[model samples]
Target: MMLDRVLRIVAAALIVGGTLTAHKSSAQDGAKIAAGEVVYNTYCATCHGDGLVSSGQTFDLRRLEAGARSRFENSVLGGKGQMPPWKGVLTSEEIDQLWHYIRDNAYQK
Candidate 1:
């Protein structure tokens, strides 16, 4: 009887803890996405267009699927077609943030 009560209480606590953890994780992700937007606007907005909207000349960033992270990285680092390389210009963390921002606004998700 006592053991059953304790188990129920423990289960409830675990559920509450998990909920809080999920909320915290979501908040952190939101912050990262926001940071990525800043990086995108500063560096990529010129060719990529404002808020990932392309003007039919450059590639539409939103068209990139979720599994295209490696492709995106390669293009950004090496430059594709007329796009210039960003190898030494942007940090890896900034790239990651840009990915997050782009992914958050991606068509797949």
Candidate 2:
């Protein structure tokens, strides 16, 4: 009985660990990043730089952490520092995709 219980616990732990790993792996995608690049080129290229390397004020978004997504989204939508607000210009989903793209590729590494 103890053996069965141990096996069950191990199996459960493995399942949970696998699920978390999959979620982390699929959290970002290239297509979404491409779309975000388009959105950025169309809207934010002038100041932020199409290369995502402009070294002015405002935190470089490429290295933003997952925990900062909400605050960053609000900041992007509401405008902060020298960056303009984009609440009306872009949908929330699009903003998220852009953020994910930036997080995944834009000077982050």
Candidate 3:
């Protein structure tokens, strides 16, 4: 009873730890965020709106919540709020690269 519970707790910890480790490693190897600056400047700057600082209701990309990364990416690719979707405009790889850029420069602390 007690031993079984302890074993289960240890197993869960190992699984969770392993998952976290893998995710961190993968995120670290994601695309070069600096390269994203040029891309953002070209396609995203006007509305987003100035220097990662917006003049409108555009959410500040430099100050994203850690968990909001996916939702932000979804909104970018599929559109949300006041912004139009870029689903067909940009490839999935571009979207992913943008995510890495934002995640590294803003979200992850």
lDDT assessment of candidate 1: 0.93
List clashing residue pairs in candidate 1.
none
Give the least accurate 10-residue stretch of model 2, judged by summed lDDT: 100-109
Clashes of each: 0, 0, 0
> Per-residue lDDT of 6-101 in model 1, one digit per residue for the tens?
999999999999999999999988998999999999999998899899989889999888899999999999999999999999899989989989
lDDT of each: 0.93, 0.78, 0.75
* Winning candidate number (TM-score): 1
RMSD (Å) of each candidate, 1 decimal: 1.0, 4.5, 6.7
| Better model by TM-score: candidate 2 vs candidate 3 | 2
Backbone clash total, candidate 1? 0
Residue 67's lDDT within candidate 2 is: 72
Which order, best to worst by lDDT?
A: 1, 2, 3
Best by lDDT: 1
TM-score of 1: 0.94
Model 3 alpha-carbon drift over 4 Å, by segment:
1-31
For candidate 2, lDDT tens digit of each residue in 1-109?
9999999999999999999988876755666777888887888777777567668654666667767788888888999877889989999778867886777764433
Give TM per candidate. 0.94, 0.65, 0.61
